[model samples]
Target: MDPYLLNAPWVNTLRLVLEVAATVAFALSGVMAAARKRLDAVGVCVVAFVAAFGGGTLRDLLLDQRPFFWIRHTEFVWGILALCIGAMLFMRQRHFEPTERAMLLPDAIGLGLFAAVGVDIATAIGMPPIISVMMGVTTGVFGGVLRDVLCNEVPQAFSDHRPYALCAFAGGWADVALRQVQAPDWAPLVACVVLTAGLRGLAVWRNWELPAWRV
Candidate 1:
């Protein structure tokens, strides 16, 4: 039973659209980041792939979706490749930007979409609500975290005062509550996407951060 289809079909179509936009943004950001790092053509693509798909890969594994979403969506792979090549060929090659300001927008989009999709898959697999929410957050952050580690830096999302992953968690769990109420399936998905993107953008704009432990 396509559990995520509880909403009207139009909602599903909207989600599919949002998901694609998010994926493309993520791919572009990842590809751009790799290029800025001065990675060779091959390294540029490998890093891009890891940054874009790592979270989804982990989420699918946890959900027991063998073969993974990227494997199933082979065009997604081709799209990533096309993006990498285009970025390399056309974009100005620059030294890696540590602050990485441009990445903020795309990363937020990626966070929202991945979190929503994670919730959908988890609910489909009959996982407990809380676990599903955690998976949602994981789906949003793991990719960038791993990408940062590979690039030999602590993830900006974690090291900074900004509420990066926190936003993802909030967005993910929001859907869980909605799921319990049996509200339109797309409500949570749309809510999470808007919330995650807005929260992250607000945090960046306002310099918002979690309260630090006063030792």
Candidate 2:
């Protein structure tokens, strides 16, 4: 089966849909972070843009795609810019708070989407399974890692509290295994998204963590 279902007449349509879903979720999360930092308009745009493009850009770079998604998907860039503006205006009206809580959902969703796509794209280019897995994990977590650095917070994925990257890594490997099973293309995609989202949700709900790194 073709890795992309919409590699059909509706390919562009599906791409637009996936791109928008990931873009909006990531843009909002980044905007929320910038709001907490009391960033100005430019800072808000920068943060939102980085968050929105971070995962995809990293995926493209690793895949050796020149120009990146943001370059080709100019509308995606504009959409995040608009969203950042709106979110900043809205934050001005309410007492917006920054909690680890807000980032969880978007991060999880983005992780699933990015991870699945990373594998698909890598596989399309004939990358080995292990490389695809690495690309998937990198595409999933590197954004939030960069986001934390920008926000001056210790990266949550690398820390004990949430273990977000660990969840993503497990899911990406699961995704690769699923594909190698030759079940269906959708099998890997569905499994990747479900496993990542489910694990992230569990971590958030139960406050799960890896055992404390040695004292």
Candidate 3:
């Protein structure tokens, strides 16, 4: 067994909490995308499942891990299903419209949590630093990218130019640095979450964007 995978009960508890938070956040973002597209209940569940598991599925594949997360933990799928159903019911009852801005916070939070978890998983598998960081970015952004594509919009991670993946990259490096400094297991996760989400939120609030390139 990998030493990194072995931890105290409280550490496992924290990891579970972070995982649930990230899953719920990404699932909500997917639900919002479905709402914006006026998707039916089936479409909503599909989008939410993709958004919640897409990145982690890819990460597990790249890591060559067995029992993909959703398969290993059936609850994740059930949770997304329940979330989509409830969100759809609530929105329908209230006749509420979901805006792009409404998606931002959840997206940011998901990005941060996924990024941190990605790095942790990669390092646990003894991957190199650069590869681990890249994995972190992939785990953070790919779900949202898939969601946007399914929604028939340009992926915000690519087109919005608001430093989305870059935020994840920075957070990944921060996680690595904290680990190098022998920080507690929870510290790196907390730092990564804060940095990634904070940077994303600030970018949106300040209208910060990368300059568009002329062809």
lDDT of 3 at 120: 86
The deviation in Å at residue 30 for candidate 3 is 1.0
Residue-by-residue lDDT tens digits, candidate 3, 126-158? 898889999999898898889998999999789
Taking all chains together, the TM-score of candidate 3 against the true structure is 0.92
lDDT of 2 by residue, 24-119 (tens): 777777777777778889878887888777877888876788888888868877778778777777777887676766667876877787777777
TM-score, ranked from best to worst: 3, 2, 1
Taken over the whole model, the C-alpha lDDT of each candidate is 0.78, 0.75, 0.86
Candidate 3 Cα errors over 4 Å, as ranges:
1-5
Which candidate's lDDT is highest? 3
Clashing pairs in 2: none
Q: In angstroms, how far off is 199's CA in candidate 3?
A: 1.2
Model 3 — which ten-residue stretch has the worst lDDT? 1-10
What tens-digit string does per-residue lDDT give for candidate 1 at 30-124? Answer: 66566556778887787778878888788887777888767767998898889888777675565434456877887887798889888877887
For model 1, what is the alpha-carbon lDDT of residue 68? 78
Candidate 1 least-lDDT 10 residues: 91-100
Using all chains and alpha carbons, the TM-scores for the candidates as numbered come to: 0.87, 0.88, 0.92
